[model samples]
Target: MTRCRLCGSTALTSVVDLGATPPCESFLAEDQLDLPEPAYPLHLRVCADCWLAQLPPLIAPEETFREYAYFSSYSTSWVEHARTFVEGAVERLGLGADAFVVEVASNDGYLLRHVVDRGIRCLGVEPSVNVGAVAREAGVPTLTAFLSPETGAAVRGEHGPADLVVANNVYAHIPDVTGFTRGLRALVADDGWVSVEVQHLLTLIEENQYDTIYHEHFQYYTVASAARALASGGLTLVDVELLPTHGGSLRLWARPEGAAGEPTARVAEVLDREKAAGLQELSGYTEFSARVAKVRRDLLRFLVEAAERGETVVGYGAPGKGNTLLNHCGIRPDLLAYTVDRNPYKHGRYTPGTRIPILPPERIAADRPDYVLVLPWNLRTELVEQLSFVHEWGGRLVFPIPELSIVEVTS
Candidate 1:
């Protein structure tokens, strides 16, 4: 029996099967489209002991993120979100010029740049050479190395332990949660705070967000599973805030054991909600595979019927979630002609497996696709506003996850 990554339990249950999917971020150059792209099994499992829904390691971090293509600065809303976090963190944590801040997986210094502007000392540890260079260019003092206990200790030796450690949207991507959390303890001061943001498992299940599952995302966490992972690595969960990001994400604030503060009611309240939602039991995860299958079938039917009606469909964002939905349903250029992304790094590249071309968002205004499938549904409100001009041509927008909904727009 394979051991669970969180609890080391051999008792695991299947959650959802996405078949084989290529690494979502592996966009191809024009000349490389003919080359064979590798796909790996995307079988997700939930640990019976800890109820952590996880995808077993299918690809290595070096293959997926070392030369990462995704850049955080491409999205305005996401950058604003990071700034909001930094502003609140500064006020709440009493961060000032003397305070030191460190961020793990700080893509392009999107969040840490705000801290630097305040004259606070900050550093970013990013493994991806592509984006790490961007962070350094932005004067955020980024290190091109993965964040492990060794790296954390070395960084701490050079510059004293950080007063604030930020690890946002990283918990899901890292394969070794145990080692990472332990490294987090080493990175922060005993009296300092560490904040980790991860998409909640409850949201993934209830919202039919199976599209969020991909090779890079190794695990999904409920509040309970997350607490357990942190506890094992010498940290104590002090507070949790449920934020309306990435469908829904929980920002967990933890502290080293010796410096652990009083627990907040928010922690218990969220855990109770998860239990009431049946996430504490193994049975909660068993029914998700059926929901996932329905989503795939429904999306395929919609795309197929739209094609028959001579309605053209195109995609909006080149997000990781979109890649999962595309490959799992086997959607190709026939269904979605091409996708538009705000990121120049992804523009001109072809999506892995499906081989759909990626272009800039500016292309949407010129082409005027009949139905624009919004792949990053979490940003539907923002995307809808930005692409509202499509209404002039009587075009509609399609949302596939949670359910298939066709939204018509008027100019």
Candidate 2:
């Protein structure tokens, strides 16, 4: 943390300090609940030199990813998003049966399963053994290993160079940006395309999405910083697309420097937007800490008032972002009661640090709480439709991000 992870500079400015919290995904089992739990610093800082917003690499990737609790297939919209991305990639890249696609950190083969259906050869390089096994079970060929320079070279040597390397929602997970980018270079063909999707820092700041900040996410990237990260491994960003997934994200298209032509005008357009939003300067981040504080205050006010009024408030979705929100707000089982999730893996566990019990999705309907706090607010539209039945018992849904609002659902 002394020097920027992306750039070796000491000029780092504080973006926001979220105090300390356990790894968002570290759900505790009932047996381990009595034991002491550990928490790490959740502060995010921006490098004045490179402008990459980052946290210190307090936890290693293996600690989080080796036996990950998150399964991408649980989210209906995310699965569809992956399917759409695969179809578009096939058409956009002119990929056919001969084409080879490799996805890094390919959790549960969410995206590559579509590639498999199309008869395009694909492989998922995933670190988590449990989730990778699920991918293999689904008939998506997966290799259980972390993406390093050697790992990428080995994959390339065994299966030949990849025609397309898709890395979605993982660019920010790795602590060593330079080494991870080089691993990407080693896997992709010289002229092949590399697509990376990461949460956009501009939207994160503007939308008051501080809950997304956690130890698992080592860094946050704007287009300017992302382009620099891509260049470190000799990849040139050729195009950029703004995506709605994960609140707001950037879909960056890159390739080897030799094959990468001039970047699309969209790249410049987003860069201009980032500059306007003060992401490249200090002004944009100045009010962020205050705004984040306001969110924490507003949420706490609602929860405490609801408790006083004898109204039950429970949470929905035990996502990593939800853990961050819960821990940062200092919410325990008393305020939240319990949260329900679609993922069976988290059904009987407790959220890290906050110790909120995670029950099955059906628990929400069985108990019929007064208010269901939607933690994974990024999937707002999809979750709204899924939880529409809440209107049955006059139950309402709550969204915390982009400001706290309680929605009256019409079934």
Best by lDDT: 2
- What TM value does model 2 have? 0.99
Q: Report backbone clashes per prediction.
A: 0, 0
- The deviation in Å at residue 353 for candidate 2 is 0.6
- 242-360 in candidate 1: lDDT tens per residue? 99899999999999999887889999999999999889887677788898889999999999999999989999999988999999999999999999998888889999889999998
- Which tens-of-lDDT digit does each residue in 287-339 have in candidate 2? 99999999999999999999999999999999999988998899988889999
Model 1 residue-pair collision total: 0
lDDT comparing candidate 1 with the true structure: 0.91
* Model 1 ranges with Cα > 4 A deviation: none
lDDT of each: 0.91, 0.95
Candidate 2 residue-pair clash tally: 0
Best by TM-score: 2
